[model samples]
Target: MVIVFSFRKDPNALSPVNCWHLILSQCRQESRDHGALSEIYSNNITLRLSHINEDVARLSKKSKEIGVQMQEELLKVTGELQT
Candidate 1:
């Protein structure tokens, strides 16, 4: 037994090489755009984290100062009562 295959040339059907080339070019462009987007996302996240860290540091410093003031006031009041 013998098998035969036939191919027809249609104007609408792209050649294999042309199809592959077009697909590769489109993929390259999409990859470049995605890379740029990823970089922007990373930078924005870093900036937000840095801002949050600075706010935490400032709050901690203020809390310590308030605590010290309270301790001093308490000590003065107790000393006067003991006299």
Candidate 2:
């Protein structure tokens, strides 16, 4: 989902880049923001994303293990019911 926000500009509060940045920032990912532009590298992004994928894979394996165990218990209960 996308979010839209409106903020009033205060000339004294922030520098032009910072002020405008706050308003414009909500429109897109912060990765496109000025600070990230210089410091963020493609390889850094790939490494972080790979870590996220690894976490997802680990969670998926755990979920499958729990599901299989539950199915086995249900089958045992069904066998008792049949006898």
Candidate 3:
């Protein structure tokens, strides 16, 4: 949003059309920067999601192991009670 105008010591130098061109160039550069930032943000989100999926898979496997152990313990306790 900031437009910088550099001119010689002469007061009446550049025309309005030239100034507009400079402004347009600056806007184009800003737009390109915005696009690059968006791409970076999207890549970061994808990477985080991939890591989260890995963690979820690991936790799920651990949970299944615990469930099996608990079931075995429950069966052992039940048999002891019946005896």
Candidate 4:
């Protein structure tokens, strides 16, 4: 038996950190199930870890993009005021 799990990023969530914690909790519960014990659990854990990594990467990229945009806007405003 094989079980695969995929996680999607939610833009409206509080933050990736919180979402990752939620995922971890869910995975832990799933792992505790005694009905079946096989490679699926290991696979699921790996998948969850990968999802968390991807989420963190995406969040970091977005943060950097927003920071750059804000900096540019501030520079533009400062330039206009000086002129």
Candidate 5:
């Protein structure tokens, strides 16, 4: 199974979170079906699946941080406009 995820910068709101969820879900499913934690580690694949999993986790965390920052900026701008 192959899934592609794209991220776009949204000035008004956070980017889609579902992409990360989809990737994580797919990784879990593949791990279960293959009966191994690191299949790409042993095989010649485009990228090491194990490393991809780690990258996904890191990206997810960064996305959350970016979302929070965007929300804060929006709130600040709204407050300034109100005053």
Candidate 6:
């Protein structure tokens, strides 16, 4: 792909070499942009995973606390029924 830059006053158009340079420049810029976007996406995913892990840990702790409480209540009720 190439672009011909010409004007009415200027008879000279863009050379093929210049066109290739422009194309390569645009390609390099696009590659950099893609790399930056990929990095941002990866960071976001890592952050979200960290948050999820923290939430899971918190829920697990709460579940254990509830389990202990239930066991205590059951023991108390059993003792009352025996007496």
Winning candidate number (TM-score)? 3
Per-residue accuracy of model 5 over 1-83 as CA lDDT, tens digit each: 99988877676663467667778899999878786635654674545676798999999999999999999999999999999
Candidate 6 — what's its lDDT? 0.93
Cα lDDT for residue 43, model 2? 60
TM-score of each: 0.55, 0.51, 0.56, 0.50, 0.45, 0.55
Clashes of each: 0, 0, 0, 0, 0, 0
Give lDDT: candidate 2, residue 26.
72
Worst 10-residue lDDT window for candidate 6 reads 6-15
Candidate 6 lDDT for residue 73: 100
The true-structure Cα RMSD of candidate 3 reads: 9.5
| Per-residue lDDT over 1-83 for candidate 1, one digit per residue giving the tens place of the 0 to 100 score | 99888888886788998799889999999999999999988999889999999999999999999999999999999999999
Compute the lDDT of residue 75 as modeled in candidate 1. 100
Candidate structures ordered by TM-score, highest first? 3, 1, 6, 2, 4, 5
The 0-to-1 C-alpha lDDT of every candidate, in the order given, reads 0.95, 0.85, 0.93, 0.87, 0.81, 0.93
Give the candidate number with the greatest lDDT.
1
Please report the TM-score between candidate 1 and the true structure.
Answer: 0.55
In candidate 4, what are the lDDT values of residues 27-50, reduced to their tens digit?
Answer: 988877643555666778789999
After superposition, the stretches of candidate 6 with alpha carbons farther than 4 Å from their true spots are 1-37
CA deviation > 4 Å runs, candidate 1: 1-37
Clashing pairs in 1: none
Q: After superposition, how far is residue 52 of candidate 6 from its true place, in Å?
A: 0.4
The runs of at least 3 residues in candidate 4 whose Cα sits more than 4 Å from the true structure, single-residue gaps closed, are: 1-41
Which segments of candidate 2 are over 4 A away from where they belong? 1-39
User: What would you estimate as the lDDT of candidate 4?
Assistant: 0.87
TM-score of 2: 0.51
